[model samples]
Target: MLAPLLSDPDTVRAADEIHRGLHALGVRDPHVQAAIAELPLEDAAAARALGRRLTRTGTSTLTVNVGIALLARLGEPEDVPYLKVLGLLRALTRPVVGALTALDCPTAALVWLADHAEIRALRHLIDAIAARDDHEARTWLINAPLDSGAVGPSTARRVAEAVQLSDILGAEQTDTQAVAQAVAQAGRLLSRMTGLRDYRPEILSYRQATTTYTAFVARAGQLPPTPDHYAILLSVALDLHSGPSVLLDWQPGQREALLHALEAVLHNESWTAVAESEPEDPAERRRVHWLRRTARQPFHRATVSRFRVEATVRDPADPDTVEARVLIDGRPLVPEAFGKGPANSPEYLLDSGRLRAAAEPREVQLAEAYCTEGCCGALYVTICREGDQVVWRDWRRPPSRQPRAELPEYRFDAGDYDAEIERAENDRTWAWPARNTARLIAAGLREQPGLLTRWDGQVGWIGTDFHDQDSTAISFTYWPGLAAGQRDKDGPWLQFVWSLPDDGTPPEHQAATALRQLAERDPKTYAQVRGGSRSHAEVLGFPWPEPEDPEVTT
Candidate 1:
């Protein structure tokens, strides 16, 4: 009876009814389970039917559980996409979770589900991974794509950290010495992974963007009233700040909805103060906020400003030769010295060391100028003059080394002075948050010294600082031999210090204290550090300690 129903495409309902009756009879029927499990994994219809029956309104709980167990045992990776569709039904939650857990390779299934499953189902997968408290699960969770409509980066990071902490705590209970050694090693691994520095302006931007997105979406009726819709909107908004062209095909209303959402999201007392200080139009005020946020994004930081091509000089030797001395806001536009122009004209001089009077004066604009302090000193633009109005074209970075003429151009009017200045101002705001995030992480580590002692490479190292300068100094001594390249030099230990701002002084001290505790608690790491290289220590601003004798107990 089961064989005929299973083989015939039209007998799905009959097969399900018979299976349900068997389930009702307390027949933990191996034959039925075997028949279901033998169905072709590629058969989406069969999988969907089983999945639907698992959640059917009148299905017995035992039947659903039985179906889940069978699916878990037999479902192939190929069945995942269809299963994901079934996973969307709230009624199937228990069975779906069971099936996911039962898969031979649950990690791959979870990842695929996270990417394609509905938000609730994705969350279920995340929760399941978090509960497992294992390295492979944590790593997969950490590497899972957060760009999916279901999960945002901030949430993903939090989940990863939680799972990491759980794993660390679990390990610490079993073996203190081993966990301590792992923690010390994790510090070194994390330092290398993030270039031995803690401060990340990009992370600050991500946090800020996520905050703004959450706030705006909470109040904005424009987005669909679902958590998944909110997550997607937030991701889309962040993408917009980085690159506006991604949303070029969106309706004006949609773009404005996002921008308006960002506006509400980023509005703060400081912005209010800035607005109050300026006598600008409401439209300009909004543009200022947009520009300010965009400036923080690496993709949108290339700024365009209005300029007047005061004079053009044509080399008498060549008719096609042209040079222009541009004025930005009535000031002579002097390109940065040693600045390389765009790749199209690498050595092309935008401003001659000395000014040349223009034979032909026309208003123009410059786009993609070095707007940030650490600019690579390049000027890229599409300058156009229409009558008395000068319009600067939005300059997109070329995909490859392409000639200037081949670069794509889009219209960007320079009439929005307020917006341009806002972007320029935002370029200077990155340092504060970068410093603060580092301090916050450091402070957390200081409070929980045990956390460092339990660090496993499987869990992320969140408190490691990225770079240090001497202007403000916080120092720690650690055996340099523990670090990757420092094992061969004549040093028992190396002192690592970072120069932070006056405001960062306390956190830097706290970080140093935490490092000291880490070094003292982990003898294995201490032994490795004792053998570190002299040169590596010197680079980190520490004189190498005296070389350790091979037999010395100290």
Candidate 2:
């Protein structure tokens, strides 16, 4: 690819071809750099010209990255300003940071770029800034490392470590304001570490977990409680009390003392007044409500229990596969301390038999370990409806672990239990675009399974699954009534892939069109069906019988 850029008379044409070629092949920045690295560095002028041209005129991200990497290796210091401007773009941040770092750009340059960067981009620059003994960078990091957003909580731990939070908190001369901010940030970090659905590095993984948390608690005691402080204290306290003891990697008696200290600060008159006042701001009110509710109804509130269903990426490596977990009174329902693995998605966790109360005692898997049930272990609980109460009992541990503290069975009022279950299941507000698309298709298929009858003799609708950001698939149990597993070696399964348009078409319209087409035409005629299990499964593409009228549908 670079040979063409180096030899071609028309640099613009060569760059455009390389960009389109790499974009089509789905080659990313690193791949481009590897290719460029293999080429001779002697062509410094060509590299600079190609890099400058691509950086200025290239539309695709990969093209600009190639230019940036090339220039980082061969260009002059004059390219610094252009690279800084490129760093402002989120997609280009990593390569731009790399280019600047490669060129040995000043810490102030990186800090300037960090000002416009999101938490994720800031993450790339944090280590470089932290490594350099720049007071400006240190001050900026200590004060503004985190923001109040989804990415903020996940990145809190990294930022805390970059700024050496434990040392700062432990120092006698550390500024009071910096100490307070770091403590509050630690609280958020701890909260994220305690989360159940997401498979994140535990709070204990941080070498300074004990020192940081204990120091935060001690300092929290000295400060007056504000509404924000109350929320942080309450959140940390609730998780510490309810979460697994393993997460409490504090010094002996430190956990207990911290809890006592938090309780005192939280129950103090100032905090109580803030909680009771119910501030007009919605975010503040919600925080206040949590404090008020926790104060009134301790850890395990009787009569009614609150259930919040949250979806977390099961593996950071694979963000598409989300795992859903239930929050029982704001603490994870799954005992994460027991080496629990990721649970199924929202539909599988809530709609599956696990959450339903039946007359007969039925066992269900709450979570599995990382390896699997056979190799590692899994958590199981039995549920049965006894009179007007639904009781969960007979907790089973995975076969491979040591005997840890047993989780007590929960008993809930049937009415309250049923309502909570339905509420969480019905709430689709947390769903992503792909999930919403799957749900829309699933609903339509449930009402009309006959749409796929012509595809095969024994096709049974299983459920919808997310394929990617813009695609979803509806799978089915495809027995075919053949000899046992003759048709599908791994039992019976078939899926119809629905690739949605990039034009901002609403999900309802997409689902309606797909359903109408399935009903009108025989899927077997147009669908390209391939056989095998889901891992290697080749899904049939859902066909469009005709062009859809945009104005006719919502």
Candidate 3:
């Protein structure tokens, strides 16, 4: 009966019958144990029988070990579920991970095991995957939920270490998809850990840091070009201004390599071109132009700081007029006149003006005092005066040769613009025509920090202490575009203020504030000082103030 059961073509059924018979004969019986151990493990029938015996309540450690060894040796991918159950019960050991690896377990299975498995077991699984040292295994490891903080710190550390090691190997692998996957995974991890949401910069740097991009580009270049390749290259160029991150530490020769890759992508005549030549499609032309511009600029680490417009005041004598003043890094910005001008000449007068005039305020203009080729252009504001006070009503770009139909008609409210700026800063993809729109907004604020008035279509100049700094602010009154009947209401005009903060604010703001004071007290010399031409410390005539650690303030 035992021989017939063992010899049956149905391996699972035979194993079950043998297990029942062995149970009836007493599992602890040395004869029964010997019989189970002696069964041929190479055959599916014998291996199932051993597995059944090992799972039984009274199975000995020696029998369990033997069963696991046989299963590891003979298990097919289908057998992984059963082996995993046993693995969970016995603690996921090296042998179990090795068996799973051998079975070519899917990533889902490994992840499921990770979710249910003990920490030690998970670490061993990570090691097992890393040990495979191939693209698929490395890709799986790259996407593992190690940073989810579900695991203890020690385990997370081990997993991170394993991934880093695997990444080094993954970077060297010839698989393009796998390498891209690794780069994306590393980028995501770095962004999450650093509280940064944009990973384009890091993704672009992967080729330089890991050689993954280099490998991918070489393989991709050999194939028929796809839109995906164009997109990849474009992404690299567009994000060139983004600084390096922990995972994508820039290295020597990386920038040059990136430029070469851009050129290679451009070499595909169907996608982009050099010199005066351009793609026929306007959108394609724009894309190529953006790429070229980004490549030319590259990434320059600039310390940006934030400032706020603390107040907009009416000149005591002029009720319809207001003067703009900004508090940057906690100091007031007063414009200083430069060039060949006496103390109160037009050049000096241009440095300050009436924010509004005594008329029905319809429009206001703000011009940058230093209108050089490199400087940003002017800002225009529209306004309406309420009883006893004035309020900024709306913002419109200065008229240009571009057809009014081509210009966007949306009037920007200061409140909305402030919110949008904040959103754009956090999410680079916040709006269509994102970077350009942001650039225009920033330029308007930087170049024209003061307000001038337009009454009956004629322009009138106004003055404010608004001036240049590492940071500055702008204020505008919003018009809701109400009906004629609704125009005479309680809140016809709303004032909104916005500030551009340094990359790290408050501290930078304070430093900027100090510098502003230094510049203002000695305008003759400091008026000529430009931010990039000299160090802030040298220009300020003192050591550059360090951002306070822990950032305490008065």
Candidate 4:
């Protein structure tokens, strides 16, 4: 799955797009070089996105630097310019940066620091930076003494120059203040590079921390819980596969809304059926609101020093049997920990039941894991919807009735459902470009007005039988109706949840009728309709009537 990226022009283009944007920002030279350096460090797709961010509109040096550092781990050149760039970034206050850099840091920075940094001041500065990071960045910086030839003003001269006489480690220059600052800064950088980014002693402890952190992000209500944040959370989850209950601090009754939007973002599937016209600022805000209001889950709030949410699976049909357990801290958290969706996660998890594909559309199964279980760090946990519901029973189970794409949520004004479906469903004439299903529906109702409400017989020899609310087949019931032991085989897979539109009626009506006619015209469309119990079983397929529209009447 990760292979195609090499030749995928879109990915290269996305990467190119980012690089161009980076050039426009003040980060053109050293920054791009640094990112190029990190390319060997991360995955190609990640590298591409990083390049885009570097090149994207109005990207900050900090953003570019982060991109470069992560990419470098994928395996970028460790060069002079990259090192110089690293020296420039050494001036920030983030712990994550340190560890990330250590994975694929610009090689040049460490060498220069060893050569020219003033000894007395080094201790103080490194300490300052390390302390700021809660000791995370400091843990990774071990000593590799300066070589006499390592010092030079050519590539990263600015680094040497800035090493304040205080930063200088002279035999006699014993300024405690200078030494303290350098020490702090060095320590901070080391923590980031090595053992500090959310390091922990136990897995359960990390889960507790994750919940607390997530809740913090949720409660702040200040940040947008922006798409990028969602993406990071997703990446973290993919990395974790299955971690502890990740409690998130969310405003009471707010977290639910983000789930759907997150789902779409994670899977790259389109959810364009939103009813309300949306504004440009937040792409899926409306959809997010809908999901939150209607997520079919059993979750309750737990409050103590902070607020958090605990979700439990109550629906028998819900496939993601295991739910994410999360805890929250009332305090506001950072943006990276905020939402449930992210465009950046490598593979988006898609919910099979929610997919809306047209009939016979190519099948696309999309579900990917995220995470490892060494169990010691700021873990990422997410509620995954992809393939959670479909227990694909491998080849043993019959093929599914669920299509890969979901029909856009159908809508209409009162009586217009028929008009809309007619327009959406069929058009018999291929020569007429503008021909729609309008004629077909008119013909169907004028002929069999009760067609939508009618049902003929069971679809095939199946394993289950079900009853319905109305006389028509839209509603149904099922017990043990097994032909070859396949569910929905006798019916629409027998009580199978149809993924099509509700054309003011159940699919059974149209489906039964369509089968009859398809057989009449072309028996090949459904060659699998051979039905009968092993002994008394005979071909019990729908009868196909001949005509322009089988279900339609003049």
Q: Which candidate is the best by TM-score?
A: 2
State which candidate has the highest lDDT. Answer: 2
Per-candidate count of clashing residue pairs (backbone under 3 Å): 15, 0, 17, 121
Ranking according to TM-score, highest score first = 2, 3, 1, 4
lDDT of 4 by residue, 421-465 (tens): 232233221101011122232234335533322322222211111
Per-residue lDDT for 1-554 in model 3, tens only?
A: 25455445565565556556655655543454345445653356565555545544324444444445555556667767766665664343555666677667775566566666765466566656555545566556676654322332233333345466334534466766665555444433332221112111223223333454343334444433433334444434323222222224446666556656656655667655342346686445544444444333323222322322212211111111122322222222222111111112221112223332233766644323223212423344454445543445454433342333221222233443344334323432211232222233433334533221110010111122123122333233322323222332443333223333334334434334533443345222222211111243353243322445221111
TM-scores, all candidates, are: 0.26, 0.58, 0.26, 0.21
**Model 2 lDDT per residue over 1-554, tens place:** 56656655577887888887887888777788778767775556766788888888888878988888888787667888889889989888878888888888877888898887776677677656666666676676776644433332235565567667777667785566756776776665665555443344356456777777777777776555777666667656655554432354556666767777777777778777877886786446544544564553223333443544554432111123345655665455665534455565676677453678889898977777656678767778898999999888888877945768877877778888888777667766545444566667766776766666545533433333332333555444333434233465454444333344323477667677777877887554444333334333334333222224221111
lDDT of each: 0.39, 0.63, 0.39, 0.29
Which 10 successive residues of model 3 have the least lDDT summed? Answer: 452-461
lDDT of 1 by residue, 342-366 (tens): 1111012222111111223322223
Off by over 4 Å in 1: 1-238, 241-246, 261-405, 408-497, 501-554
> Could you tell me the C-alpha RMSD of candidate 2 in Å?
10.4
Worst 10 residues of 2 by lDDT: 545-554
